[model samples]
Target: MASDYWDRYFRRARRMRTSRRRFLLGSATVGIGAAGLGLVGCGDDDEEEPTATSEPGETPDPTATSEPGETPDPTATARPEETPQPTATATEAPPDTSAVPTDGSYYSQVGEPFVGITLDIHRGVSGIAGGVEGSAYSGLIRFDDIPAPTFRGDLARHLPEQPDAVTYIFDLRDDVVWHDKAPTNGRPFTMDDVRWNLDRQLTRTLADGTVADDFTLTNTVFTHIDSLDYVNDETISFTLKQPRGTWLESLAFAGFMDQGVAEQIESDPDVISADRIVGTGGYMFTEFVPDGRRIAERHPNWHLRQAGEEVQYFDALALLDVGADVNAVRIALEQKQVDWIGGRFQRQAYAPEFMQAIQDANSDIERLDVPALNANRALIYSWEIGPFSNPMIRQAFYLALDRQLVLQQDFAGEGRITGPLPWAFTDWALSEEEILQQPGYALNKDDDLQEARQLWEAGGGEDLEDNIELVANEPDAVRLSEWFTAMMNGNLGTDKIEVKGIPGGSILPYLTGEDPIAFLTPVSAWTSPDPRQRLARSYTTAGSINFGKYSNPGMDDLFDQAAATLDRDEAISAMKDIQRLAMTESGAGTILMAAATGRFLKWPYLKMEFNPWRLPVDERSWIDQSDPTFSGRPSL
Candidate 1:
């Protein structure tokens, strides 16, 4: 089947030559239409990393989305009073729209919402569009779709062209539609909308000349672009200020914004919730009950189609925000009140007992226990301000962190140590053996600990204020933070650093504000396959979430060179240099931590073809109503 798809893909490439989006590009660069998609597996984390199944030189198998059945109003679909494990029943009725659609509904933990009036979707969390990283958004191309990282065009017609190191040309897709809602009213998505959105990301100022706060959350991705030009309504091009390795891949991070949304935000600023969402995604915002329930019904007139039929299988999608209680989430899954659970990067959210029950039941619940490589990241300090500004202190802290211990205890010893890029992106990230030899990652830490104390003493960190604050983005991280503190205090001094458990909602502001709290380890869900783009987003001086404001000109230059260099070896060398500079040598800003493999639970009814990052719940997902494991699902 994979061979047949690639055969068709190559044949299609041959046919598309000198026509439409495939025009004039090399055969290797041409993209297949929506009909063919390469199979991909993904990691559930705040940051994105590609997981390739291929061996050293073998081409991995490809998978395709089955044609979508067609896709309504969201009532919360309150959890039906769960019956005992032996049987299941629904006391309350499912809303009308949900019942009408045969495609299954998916449920997962969407962390708290961002509270500002503006939508900070660029930062991965929105005021209303809870974790809009890949959902509730559309970019020029579906460039970063995980597991495979194939360049399946979304808004743009196909893969783009780099006429030179600093220029990119693209042909726009003609069939595009905004969700049928107010402000947008099912308007055709056009080049004007593209310009409007990119302008905000490229510049800090809005149309009214007022400072754009959350709208500019992704400025770092576009810092290279000096200008953008619309070559008629069908085409567009970008002129970069300088050559950048991440220039092409970085576009995936820019989810297009609607003109109406901008105007609406500019006027009231307070109404930018999920209810105000006007996306080009298959799902449209239907209901949003703060901290409670949120849902999106399908767009009947969705533009992306296969064989003239809408592509999304689910008629409506519900994101259940049942808070931190593991037993409650487990019970919801056990009784079949919700279709799935244990995602949104909080792997620890699903209790071990729940997984044991699934395994012990001997039923095909369709679960995957995979490695979570990307989420294994460390906290960056406010280098521009306090104690962390000292490289000696930063290196000492990095050296003192016991990543292997954390992996063994908290993560159950499932994953491996990570550097700038996680282990998932096999194509580029440094090898584990190479990483183990680094200063802080050595197996024997006795020398490392002595060196850490010496560095701490030499840097005058011993004279600093007591209890340096360490903030974590979510609850699971609180434990990691505590462990870090204990390790540091035990290694350096009796009382050195303090742990602060910050809620996801307020952490962004805490990190991005005028006076950000000391240190933070955010769960950044970066889904791009390229390493340069990751560095551009979090490591660059203009990074969207360079919370600690750590900057290194040499590393920045290396990133640009890596992006612009076409030779794979040259690009990879530049990449390693960037990682070593930021993660190891100078600017010891980022501390690479351990990646934990986790188990994702889903009902057999959900025909999920691949391991989705955030369930990127898309057109491919359908329901197998007759699957035996779906036996006792609640009646509508």
Candidate 2:
């Protein structure tokens, strides 16, 4: 087991080294431009340069897969009623690989007679990477350009039609087609594909009517669904076990897994490659190199464009990871290798001078803070063991944390006071103005400290006589955790919370083990901006991701009341009550701290659609290399 871990570690170290070397060498050669990388077919819509050519590289040593250990559902819901003729033609012409640009990923004509621009942004992610998936894939329902509570159907003509609270139906778009490749050569996408995607997350049973032993439950949001039945070739229906208002919103969370290669790649890691991923989206999957880059080139016959929609300006979309270490991300931004940078989770460390220099050089660049309300900071206690078992101690622990210090240390002082939810979902969340008045989030902390100490003493915290291990998950949380250990001790006038920093992945096993520790981690508290969304994922008794194991009968009742209601106001009332119960009215066991707002230094030339959902790089995000900012990019 340790050997497998080290095997991954050394392989990654090697990649990081190679990435740094390439970036540094590229940085030194500023004038190389797209020309140096052998870019071909940049575009002629605005009459630009050209694109490039490369073999599709599939990484066999995959550390992350679609859903680790997941297999296609063998339940066989229904056979395809009919097979429609495939549409959406791919570019018959071979790729034009004339010149090597300084950034080869910048220009790609893998499957394109497309817009000439190529995008390169900083991204550090596992699996196929979000940009590759989001760009190539089409979901039943999708978030619009904005990240708020706005969404529209992509494959479906509109949001599913709900005939009853427990029943929903989707109207598929006839023109949508699978990407032109292998088993499914640009065939019209249909209802069957939707069902396959749905079943990927649904619980599956063997022919013996027993739940499969190793079936991967990729997502639990679909658990409410009782059954999925085919209505017709273009129509599908879903039956729910019970009525849920947020069910439609949850469908927005569903992404279509291409049926084209279901048998070949669904459960096979050996063949799973980001470049080989096929979907009906703005961009075609091109390539993905771990810790180096991810690329998706323009799809000439993308359904939207086939419908004569004016979208997807960039000839190709690229995410250059370099190495996720803070320096690599910062250097990419500093050198203009990326058009924009910053997010709630990303640990961005940049000097003011570096930012000022960009403004000095590029008058078109803009820096703005985007609220990712769901990306909230949460305090989850080990309620089953130790001091955290006591509610008073739990509350005391939460009350003593200096949120501002976490903001200052981990986020470079660019964040908000998150009590339970981030402020982005203004409709369903407590505003920063209101949250500031909460006990721990208040501008002044004198009363909060006094109460925390009193509670600590009253709860027999001194009896433990040991430093309470507090887990801080993720890199940013780790930085703030080290500082909070000292701050918390000083606040209580006694040594108390000790920082136990761990990677995000390790938090699950540590928390779910024989003796779990209290943890602080980032939660997508605003998954749907539906209050029940968070409750279902993390708060309720049956919650799939409720790592803390925090539960209350009253809280579950509130969720039921909200889900049963069709009245928006009534559901919200119940939702707010649940939020109140999380920390305001009750336990120290679980504290929701709304922390961090994302700030991005965006170049004017980047007309990319950046939303908080999935990865920030939207396929349709406009990229105009002809802009003055493009000419201003670092050249060798």
Candidate 3:
């Protein structure tokens, strides 16, 4: 079946070559679309890294009128039972909306109230849109209609290309509907939403795992010192204290929720359930049956727009998560049991066969291969060990391994092995010389053997045979580890090395100082563009995700500096310095670079954009799947 898909993909590709102009670039910027939707930020804490959002402001509105599913009377007055007692009439303060359009028709002309989509989420949401529960609500006020991180320095209207500074202000939309139709429920999501969500993350503790990064809240440099105040009945003001270059990006974060919406969910969880979910997105939850199937339909009152003309493309979306396995996905696609493949199924495991089968079966069916922004497979060493604790021994190990042989034999030559940074991220990548300068980056086999022999002799004697353990998670890592052990044993003698390959998840317990040593450990990323995440997590004792518990103050300070400064160049420099320190000094762990191996069946209509460093949620870069014209069909 997989072979069939690949055959179809090649045929489609050959056909497309005759006329199609748009080539799959393999990489694109997601900051724009993500920022425009105001959908930035880590969706959950336990699962991802801390990235920026447009603004650390407001929860999504939960009021039936403000949300997509329901509409409400803008003029309707709420009874006391409907909303919590007003602390004060914020509307009395009076906000300025002179710059905003007064005409109600402008809002209506925006077209269809909603479009629905079904996404096969690999994991479950933490129940918080941003920080508050599913119930917080508000209407689209004056929204920053641009993508993330683009409006950096201008103070202009609409979406500034670049702002003179990082400050952006928005006015709340009027007549917006929420999921629940209640007006008095916390004043229809005002400036209070912005302030409340940030405060909740900083102060509250819920069973949900979606907590804000400790640094974003406590670190003075990364903090948002913005002021929020209601301007009028249908308006509010947001002013940032400092130049937050990624203000729009920050706004899209998972942590920012509206105050009013959160209060509703906190008050009544019954208002929302597993199947009856709510959000301001184009889709509304119709039903979810755990491992069975989940469905969502277009909301009648959602605010949406078409790309060319002003109309919604999708009438509704049906997301089905049959299973995580690629074989299962192939079966479903064959049976036409699903509309399209969900994100979870988009992995290297699909192999050439799986994609080929799909292509061969249907001409209308195309693949959406979006190379994710992340270093998929990394070779991480444990620095707090017997042999690896020494920089010389670590370097010797790095130098001795044959990457070319390993890539061909173990990974079937499909994998790419380079330095610490993945190959796709060439911009911030360090050169071979720079990599070699790092403590253990050198892989000079002959020289390294001589050095290892010298070190063993210097430490004690040539008769030494210390049984050492080599550990990794995947079959490839196991194969590579075995080959490496053989090389070490053959070169340095049998008494020196013993190799063991454990499954990825099982390696955790031993990594936490249980075993005296390990190598090529796997750790998931929280977010990208934050250098401190990789640095501190792997090198510092305080790192929550640090599996090796490798500690070095020199590397720690570099991580701090990179994290402290907002300057991109300065951060880049700091990261390079840390990379050097880790590789050379064995500060945290020496990386023999990272490798990612995968095969995707290419189709004419199917486009691939890889972001090897981005969060998993952003993999939407595949096949412009969102385009209505796509239909898994190639353009003439």
Cα lDDT of model 2 by residue, 410-443, tens digit:
4455445665545544445565676777777777
- Name the candidate that leads on TM-score: 2
Task: Provide the TM-score for each candidate, comma-separated.
Answer: 0.69, 0.70, 0.61
- lDDT for each residue of candidate 3 in 1-636, tens digit (9 for 90 to 100): 322332343343345324322111111112211111101111212111111110111111001111112333456676867765578543432332221112110000001101121110101233222111111212221121111112211111123222334433444433233333333321333345445454554444333535434212222212454564555544434456655423333333323333444455544544433333444443344544433434444334533321121222233333355555667766655544443432212322334454656878766554443212231334455666566666556555555455554444433444344555433233344664565544334455566566656655554434435656666545535555556667666665445666676654555455565656565432333133333444355566676545556787776777666654556667667767766665555335535343333233322222222222221111121233433434533211
Pairs clashing in candidate 1?
Answer: 39-63, 46-524, 46-525, 47-524, 47-525, 47-526, 48-526, 48-527, 245-563, 245-564
* lDDT tens digits by residue: candidate 1, 1-636: 332343343343244223323211000111111000010111113332211110110111122323334332244554579445666653554343322335554433344443432453443223233242235667787532343344456787767777776778888888888877877887889888887777666675665787655442343455667888888988899898876544454465466767667666666765545656678877787776555567777676666653243257766666566556767766767777666555334333444565667656745555555445343546666777777777787778888877787666555565566777666555567888888888778889988899988998898776886557776645545565566678878877647677876665675567667763455342344334345555555677876456667777876788667767756568768777777777665334555576655455666566643332324456454666655666776642
Ranking by TM-score: 2, 1, 3
Alpha-carbon lDDT, every model: 0.56, 0.51, 0.38
Report model 3's TM-score to 2 decimal places.
0.61
By lDDT, rank the candidates, best first: 1, 2, 3
- Per-residue error at 373 for model 3, in Å? 5.5
Alpha carbon deviation, residue 604, candidate 1 (Å): 2.9
Least accurate 10 contiguous residues by lDDT in model 1: 32-41
